[model samples]
Target: MASALQYIEETIICAEILRLMPRFLALLLRALIKRCLRSHEAIYVTLLPVADQRCLERDTRNLGHDLPKHADCIQWIMESSSRKAPWSGKRVVHELMAIWFGSVHALTTTVTFAIHDLCLHPEYTEPLRAELEAQYIQFLKSGRGLPLLDSFIKDSSRLTLVESSILLSLSAK
Candidate 1:
């Protein structure tokens, strides 16, 4: 969604597509979007059984030397996969694409719905904002906790689950 947000803001077409997509009769449109993104990535890493492991190695080298240490899902995947088996670049890329697709969609939907609810219920906003701000400062200073923010996120995710009825109807079609 963050990536989509960039395009959505820069282009009316992307914004309109996003607005119209949810009302589509089926999830084919969303699936197409995911496939399109996947195909683009596949050009770099065929995600085939024979994909070169050197890409992951180069990325790791770049991470340590060229780029600053950063916490990222792909990095975690590389590290964890290396600890287990002979690193398969294809498997890592495949898993990374799947994880990215699931995370982007779920998080974007969750955050959007949460913000919409917060806007509708202004009464809860102030308290949440206050708690987040206070905890954010402490977090920046000590890096210890963010209990209220964490709870709010958990509640938001619980409240805004994609309706199973919608999924059922789509699948029936």
Candidate 2:
């Protein structure tokens, strides 16, 4: 049997690993999607021209060049103690680890529970599928409306009980 300290250490390590895993999986999936999209070069080119062109431009300007430097500066301040100056790498890594922890824990638990509920609720599956299909048709017909789909998603998420911890954490934060 493990000692108490050993058990606690193991638990912490396990939690850290769990936190890191989803970030890794997301990175992998994003790369895979990018690769798949690149493979369909013509389709991408045709759609790229008109697909929320301003939104794309805004994201490009706001996201990459501006955000990371500001985040790094804040991270540096957070990592610095009064007595000692902060190292940049340590600050950046610490902030990244915090982000990984928050995103992975919440997203993994929510998605896992959602999948499990969908698997268990065989009777509701067809109706839910039909509802989604009908919603898509309605969305195409109307300029904007996501009522049925949004409600279904919200209800499913509520029933899953996955967001409780996330809500608590957000409140604490």
Candidate 3:
């Protein structure tokens, strides 16, 4: 299981299509799409066995070995209000993809964009660092965040969002 997972980890999320000369880029995009899809499906196929095992004993629906300890998100999702079942292995795998995108993907992408933007706009670096140092002291004193840092983070996130992505921005007080 570990070796198989290691192999999957080693698989590149996308092939080197961007490096191809301009003319070939268009042609290779389709191949890149296919490769990504296959990689995605490979993960689903890998998890089918575990999902099947978890679904087998619905009465005791405890996916983890440790009793009363918090189980992993996959187990929680299976038990969540939306998923009542006699769960098929395929359904479990599909749900895995859904849960991952909503939580893991969103968080990683948000952090990635935030970090990338920080690199792109070096002017804000010192100010943000100083703000964070000040904020840490303030937090220890009163557990409150300063408006300047909050607004900056919110605005940075808002600006970094892609055109096609939907984001509802709530003003930070």
Q: Which prediction has the highest lDDT against the true structure?
A: 3
Per candidate, the number of residue pairs that clash is: 0, 0, 0
The ten-residue window of minimal lDDT in model 3 covers 164-173
> Model 1: per-residue lDDT, tens digit, 1-173?
44433322222222234445566733565455545543334333444433344444546665675644436655566666655354567666656654554555566666776788777777877888887777888788998787766676777777754534443232122
Q: Ten residues in a row with the worst lDDT in model 2?
A: 1-10
Q: If scored against the real structure, what TM-score would every candidate get?
A: 0.45, 0.34, 0.55
Residue 118's C-alpha lDDT in candidate 1?
74
lDDT of 2: 0.45
Better of 2 and 3 by lDDT: 3
Q: Pick the candidate with the highest TM-score.
A: 3
RMSD of each: 8.7, 17.0, 8.4
In the range 1-173, model 2's lDDT, one tens digit per residue, is 12322322332333343344566674464445434433223323343343334224334554565433233433343435342442333333334334444555555555655567677777667776787676777778884665644565566677754334433332122
Q: What C-alpha lDDT, on a 0 to 100 scale, does residue 34 get in candidate 2?
A: 37
After superposition, candidate 2 runs with Cα above 4 Å error: 1-92, 104-108, 137-173
The lDDT per prediction is: 0.54, 0.45, 0.55
